[model samples]
Structure formats: C-alpha cells, structure tokens
Target: MSFREMTITLDDVLAFLHLPMGGRFYTPGYATRAEAAQTCALLLGGSASDYALKFDHVKTIGLRFGFLQELYTKALRDRRYGPATQMWLVHVVGSMLFACKSGGWYTTVHWISIVEHLDQVLEYAWGAIALPTLYDALGHASQRKTKQMCYYTSLLLAWVFEHFPPTIIQRMEVPDYTEDQPRACRRRESRTGHPELMERQVIFDEMTAEDVIWTPYEEHRDRSSAAVSVDGAYADYEPYLIPEGVPATIEGEVVGNYLDWYTTVSHSVYHPG
Candidate 1:
C-alpha cells in the first residue's frame, strides 16, 4: 500500500478551534524559582515563601494546576478581581492550551510572567505557540518508550475527524451548533469500545484518496462564517500557507524542508508489532 502525506495546518487550526493567531510570538523564557516566587507574590498576593512551596520540584520552577486553582479561588473570595482573572487565565492557558507532559498537571513558571501585566495578555501569539507545541508533542509521542503526551491534542483529533471518513470515527450528533461555536464543538467522539491498535492500523492501510473527505466542512461553512473571519484581529497567517511544492521561507531561507524530512524519518510507535 502506498502512503500519502498528511498534516494539520494553520488553516485547520483556525477553522476548527478558532484560536487567536496574532500579536507578538509567545516566547516564555525560563524563570528561576526566586523570580517565579516574586511574580507569584506580586500577581496573586501571596508571600514569597508560600509561593515557593508551590513549585513542582527543586530543579524545575513550575506550578501545578491545583495550586493555580487555589490561588484563583482565594483571589475571588478576597475580591481581588484582577488577580483572580489573571490566575484563571494562567490556569486555562497552562492546563488546556500549553500543557506539559509532566504527569499532565505542571506548567512552567515562565507562563506567569506572560500574565504579569494583564493589559498585554492578549498580545501573545497563542495559536502559533499551541500549534508548534502540538507538533512537538506528536514528534515525541512517535518516539520509542514515549508513553504520554500533552498539549492541545484536540486540534489533532479534530483535524483527523474532519478530514477522514466517518467509518474510522465514532462521532455523536451535536444538536445546537451555532455561528459562534468552533467547528470542533459540532462533533463529539464516543468514549467506549474503541478499536485496538492493530485494527486501527488495518483500517488506515486500507484507506485511499477516495475515502478522504477533502472538504468535510463545506456544508457547515455558512454556520462557521463568523468564526473564520480574521478582520484585523488576527495576525496575517495566510502568507505561511503551505501549498503543494511551495516552500515556506524566512529571511530567504527555506523552512519547508521539514516536509521532506518527515517523509524520510522513522516513526516507530511505543509498542512492538
């Protein structure tokens, strides 16, 4: 059986998830424990020592989602509205969008700095960060002994469900989808009785171009019209589109070589055949 190259693109991310793809790139630099504690105290109104105790470990200055939730609750109870909202944002961004593989709970302290000034939270390129993160996680998960992965996996799942035939997916009906809802919201994957690994591989091996849904969302385009509007709010992501045989370049250097690289790379799964 011949193989076909497939990928999740910025267009898929925008159409399915409706994440913000504009503003300054998200570059959360590393933070030492002292710096993390200081930021936590200033933003969440806690003592430095108390904040220090929330770190995930001695070497990594990271905080758990549980700790962030506690701080969020405390800020709300104390009527510190600003801190509460910041804490909530941190928790959501960390746990939902940029989660790490550390037991699926810890997030680096560097994210706290992003929310340091509330006015600038919306300025970061969250979708840009999320897509790369998902790509990284996928690469890692493809490696041997890699037992787990974290990040916005919903994007990958949604892209697959949208592009592939429904025979491979167990989707539930979404009755009340609206213009404001993300395309992902219209389909739900059933939880029970999924196919085993080899069964899934057989199904994939049997797939042909005719089985693919090139434009599965065409019927829903009218409902999703508002969700896909860029309208000066998002960054110009169109220039990065990866059309067939076209190279993506930066400073006149081709970066789309990854397409070739991925085709040749060995992608062994964690389990033995």
Candidate 2:
C-alpha cells in the first residue's frame, strides 16, 4: 500500500474558523487551589469555598461546564450582566477552544484568568494554542486503550469533510455560504447513519489520489480577495506554510532521535501522486 501525507495547515484554521491567528501567545501556568478559588471569586463574584469545591481533582484545578453554566444562569437572574458574560466566554474557551482530556464538561481555571480582563481577551493567540491542543488530543487518541478524545474536534471534522470525497463521508446537504459566517458553519455530518468499522476500513483502503478533493475552497478563495493583516506583536507563523519538499527540521540530537523513531512506526496509507 502506498502512502500520502495529510495535514491541516494554519491557513485552514484561519479560513475555516476565522479565529485570530495573531496575538499574545497564551501559556497556561500552574495555579494552586487557593489561587484558582481567588480568581473565581474576584472575577466571577462567588464564594471561595464553593469555587474550591469545584477543584475535586488536584491535577486539574478546573471547574465543570455545568457549574459554569449554573453560575451564568444565576448571574443573569441577579442582573449581573458583566460577570454573566465573562462566565459565558470562560465556558466557551474552556469547553470548546481549550478543552481538557478529562472530559467535555471539565475545563481548567487558566481560562478564567485569561477572560478576567475582557478588553484584552482579543490579544490572545487562540489559534496557536487551539491547533496544538487538538494535535495533542489526536496523539492521545491514536494510542492503544485510549477510548475517547477531546479538544476542538469540530475543527478536525471540518478539515476532513472539506478535503475528503463525499463518498467516504456521506455528508449531508451543505448550507449556503456567507462572508459573515466561518466556513465550518456550512458543512454538516451525515445524519442518516455511518458504515461499520470494516466497511470504513475498506473505503479507506480503496481511496486514491483521484478520490480526494485537493482544493475544495477554490471558489471561496476567489471570493475572499481582501487580504487580512497580522499584527507585529505575534510571531509570524510562516513556517506553517506547505514547503516545496521534505521539510527542514530543527538541528538537534533529540529531534533527530525522535525523527528516526517516528519514521519506523509511521506509515502512509495513500499516495496523492
């Protein structure tokens, strides 16, 4: 069997999700239970004890999505619009953008710290963090005995539906495209049913270069003529661009050893050419 390299580029994230590709890099730091509880109380105006209880696990000093939702609802009832909105954004970032592997409902308090100052929230390089988090989830899911996966799965699914043939996906009717909406909003997964595991394996085994849609966004590209600019504060993510040939690697013994190990286990399933 031949092999083909399939990658989801930074461009795909920018175009498909319209998430900011440039901003201050978000690096999560360690926070103790006291610190996390303080953050929740100061920003979200809740009892420190109640917030402390949410940190059931020491490793994941985070709150549940259900807890956040309850806070949001309570805030709305009390007419505390500002805190309510902040709670909502916190829930979105934690549950959707930077979800933890613990489950879909649990999210770390790190996002609460980030969302504390709403005015500066846009200054975060969300796309940078999100892509890598998804990659991490995919890596974990690929391991033996890993039954479930988390993180922003919608991005991965959208990438697959856009690049793969409909025969393999059995996609539903797509919605009309609009410049205001992200590309991901238009596509939906099959609602009828899915093929069995063996059937899917056969479909993948038979996949060829002709079966893949190399450039599904050609029309959208033409329509989006206006160029978007990146701020100078953010790292120029030019390295994410597809290279001409075998990509350059960082010169280091560790990297070299990893590359050797990866090459032995990794096998391509399709050849584009």
Candidate 3:
C-alpha cells in the first residue's frame, strides 16, 4: 500500500510485459494494478449488491427450487457463448438487483457506467490469465482452448462476486456448487420440461469437500516430491548432462526398431493434429 511498494509493483508489471513467454503475471492484456484495484473497489462498494441482486435473487431462487430450469441448459448448449461471456451477461442483467442490494452509489449513472466498465474488465481479465500459456503449449491452439479457459475463468469471477454482499447468498440458502456440478437447484422452463440451473456459485466454509473440486493445472504437475525413479548411473557424478546440447542418436537397426514401435503405439494419431 505504500508509495514505494506501489511503484515497485508497477515496475514489476512493466517488466512482465517485456517477457516473451506466457503465464507470467506481467502479461499485456491484464488490467493495470490500479485498474484492478478500482474494479475491486467498485464491485465491493456498498451499492453494488443492491444493483446486481434485484434480478438475480428471484431468478436464482426460482432456478434453485426447480421453477424455470431450461434457462442455463440452453445457455450451456450455445456454442457461441463461453462461461466468461455468459457471466458478464448475467452481471449486466442482474445489475439493478445488485444495485438495490449494494445501496451505496448515490446516482444511477454510477451504477450503469460501472457495469459497462466491469464487463470490459472481466473480458480482458479472463483472457489475460490464460492465453499466454495456451499459446506456449503449441505455437497456437484452437478456439476450443480459448473457450475452455474463458468459461472456467468467468465462472471463477462470478463465484468471487456472488459473495460480495454476504447477505444475498446467506439468505438464498442454496447448496454449494462448483465448476464440475454448477447447479445446486433448478427452474423448470415452461415450454420444454428442461430446468435452468445456476451456473456460478459461492461456497462457504460449512460446505463439505464433496460439494466441490478444484481444477488441475494444464502443465506437468508433480503431486508429491517422492522419487519416481533413481539415477544409479549418474550417482557418481555431481552434475550429469552438463552444458546441454543434442546428444548422438542411436542408428541403424535400433533406430528402425524405435521408429516402428513409435508408429505402432503412439497416441498422437488420435490427438489433435
């Protein structure tokens, strides 16, 4: 919070933009620290809940109790909309309700402007978090990966804000939901017997572990430090494979045998090409 620390953080962010690789905190698309802080402030303002909750509260409860269910099902089925886009839409729709709950902003202008601003911020924030890594894995990934990330990250942001007014979620009394199984309840759609469920949710400490599961990382994940294989051949050497460079490849019959085995058993055939 100090001036010097703030300056240092800004410098760090600028430095991060300089890096060519993905997954660094300093990446380009993110809101600046100041912008992020402003968003947090506006979102957390006293009036935010009032403005956002009005529409959401009734719809959420209806969806929870099996009243109008087909809502989320169609949303889910839509190939064009991902989670993040859907969440921003929900926020925009529920703005007035949230404003009523928040009861902080004096003027309507503040509410409307903030909603538009937050929508833009949310869009950028979701991309900023995941794109670089996606690009790094392969020179480029399909739109599917982008959608996957957007959907999950938007859900993440929604869960974060749902608890903004503490009272709204507490009074709603719905079961906890996570990305895997997002709806704790449903609303039956009038035309189709389908039920619309809540896509984004907040979990409390009282919620059991069975209610949620955290996502696994996209890259190599070592669950434990326990040794998998020992290098007996290199035990005598302090540093093996020093000054990394290409090593000679096995040739002739060995190469032919390896190639045959690779072609026969490789999973790449079924993988994305």
Give the worst 10-residue stretch by lDDT in candidate 1. Answer: 263-272
All models: lDDT? 0.71, 0.73, 0.29
TM values, all candidates: 0.77, 0.77, 0.16
lDDT of 3: 0.29
What is candidate 1's lDDT per residue for 173-265, written digit by digit as tens?
A: 688976467788877887865777777767777777778777665556566653554434534655675555755443224545554565466
RMSD of each candidate relative to the true structure: 5.2, 5.7, 22.8
Q: Who is ahead in lDDT, 1 or 2?
A: 2
Per-residue error at 266 for model 1, in Å?
3.1
Cα lDDT of candidate 1 equals 0.71
lDDT of 2 by residue, 95-168 (tens): 77766666446877865678778889899878777888788788988888988887788899889888887766
The residue pairs in collision within model 1 are none
Highest TM-score against the true fold, candidate: 1
Runs with alpha carbons beyond 4 Å of true place in candidate 2: 57-59, 100-104, 225-263, 268-273
